[model samples]
Target: MTAEEETRTAAPAERLWDLAGRWHGVAVAAGILVLTRVVQILLLVGLDRAIPDPAGLRSNLLIWDGGWFQRVAAGYPQGYTYAQNGALEGNELAFFPLYPMLIRALSAIGFDPGSAALAVSWLASLGAAVALHLLGTSLFKSRRAGWALVGICCGAPMSVVLSMAYSESLFLALVAGMLVAAHRRVWWAAGLLGLGCALTRPTGAAAAVALAVAALVAIREHRDEKKWPPLVAAAVALAGVPAYLGWVGWRVGEVDAWFKIQTAGWGTSFDFGDSTIGFLSDTLTLADGWVPMSVALILLVALAAAGVALAGRPWLPLAVYGIVAMILVYGQAGYYHSKPRLLLPVLLTLLPAAAAAARARPRVAILAISAWAAFGLWYGAYLVAVWPYTI
Candidate 1:
């Protein structure tokens, strides 16, 4: 091949790896995590001071899923039982074991469960940011674009969840890693990551779908002549579903503990048009002060949908993931509060926009991303300050 052709062929891979290996990426990711955690701590402290009653504050600010996680972390699993409303008639099997399991393990290592959970989440958030950077660079073939993508994630509204004791960060990291492996045609790695993601969150099924579709496309384009590892990888990724269900059944005496728990505890049954209409109605009426929040949410949702629609064929895997995730989110009943959290993965939609902008006006893309990051920082700080009351 000619030198120019060779350079062009190798440039994307080289740029991707170089960006992945850089100290700048590491520093930026670390900075985001640190800032987020600091905000969390400040929020906690502020809540404590404002409430005066520590118990009441804890019950309010850090209650719900956070409280349950703390209990699991404290090595008190024997009394563990799911409750619909503080009553122990429900099955604890409904809750996935991954995050709580990690919290328990970390507690065994001498760290408090709360601290351990937060620490793990913080690290996972950083990893997700890095994975996002690499994914963007690979898809866009520009290190600068990758950096901008990472920067945007650092500031994304979802940073609030990343800083908390939630499983979103870890789930995002696993999903991103799986995507990276799929892109490289590393089937086994993709499958393993997908399984891990499944264990982390139920919505992780989206990763398996994305990978499976990608593999199918690869197989068809090659007329089954090429050895496509993605087929096997996709299978491996889906294996987590049965494995997790079996474990939950054995422990909770029900095969659908996870589903039941989500349904009963969170009222998350599927309801497509109703949920969407509810959100839209609320947005229009400005009900529950939904104006600003709705605007932001709509912008994100629209961008994600547009990106998938515009990609035509090259972005099939991402499109599949995005579409499935949106369906899952919007299909749920009583989705007003949780919809934003569920749409966290949709942030990947920004990747195509970042790519298009980088190819056209790289500098403008960088500036825009930087502005988003700044907003993220400010929003995170505000959340920390008012988390006890509003979060």
Candidate 2:
């Protein structure tokens, strides 16, 4: 009945209420994600109906990367090898295991691998939207801003990749989860998520670096740092790299299995200088002829600029992740066409802007996001159904 006791008791209840309030944005994001997935499914179904056998259409509908992932999921890895012209080649080592792993697990329970892959990816995409909402809410200190950020990400052109059997949705979910855990200073969770991210895609390295840097900064700031959570996070995040590398090394008797496979098999070499210049030149030169290429290039520049602008803010984690992501994508010697999808995670930069936008004009933010989502839906449908033929 004392005032201090009442205040203490009330504080916890207030915090719970605040947390509940923030999740409204997550619900809204879920709605948007579901709607987008539904649209994609409808388009796919329509396409399937139009083309009974759909064999020839498959080549156009499911081009390069998607076919590789499907083949891997279908248990045809034996036909694949690490080297391109080294005789053994299919898809075994070329693609990472996480996505296929999910497909396999789902298939074990009687689901078709391809359908399972798509289903798992769809769910992961929803999880990613939720994670983005949470991340934005945490960074901007507003639920509205969080919702706006989720809308932007879900509506972005890259959102179409989520429907595919690709690792983007899975990776995005892991990365976003890692970011949220890091923002809360929950080192163990963040580290675990970081490890999961590494397992998902190459960008996992960027997530690991961002988490490690954040942890180091937290340690340096705390004079009596007895807990050492950040260090724990960094260690956990890094554990996956060595474990993965060691496995690959043991399997192939090479410490550089990953690098070699990446280079030789996928034509992904790390030529920092030429890679950066080529990306810029190609982007500028091809900007007029190709719409996707142009949008990707502009988005890359926008993300880089956003990172720089937000670097001084309290949310240094976002800037760190964005900068590292941009650097990684720009450093790639091949897959230049994928620069847009590669920069998907960097869209986290939009969180800060979303927060500011929410404070100034929440309606404007929502409207813009809606427009983008509409475009993404239309573009994704077109790509799956029509654009593949044109290409």
In candidate 1, what are the lDDT values of residues 178-278, reduced to their tens digit? 88767755567778888888777767778788888878876777663345467777888777767876776666676666566657655667776486666
Give the Cα lDDT of each candidate.
0.65, 0.69
In candidate 1, position 93 carries an lDDT of: 51
User: Could you say which candidate leads in lDDT?
Assistant: 2
- Candidate 2's C-alpha lDDT? 0.69
Residue by residue across 1-391, what tens digits does model 2's lDDT show?
6798567535633543375264565578798788777776566566655654653433433455666666667663322263445553333565666777887888889986667777788789988988877777676667776677777776666566777767889999999889887776667788889999877777777788889888877767765544576888877876765676566666766776667667765567777748667656776776745665655565566666576556646466666787778777777776554666676677555655575557767677767767767776666655556444321
Question: Which residue pairs in candidate 1 collide?
Answer: 82-92, 271-331
Clashes of 1: 2
Residue pairs clashing in model 2 are 80-89, 80-90
Best by TM-score: 2
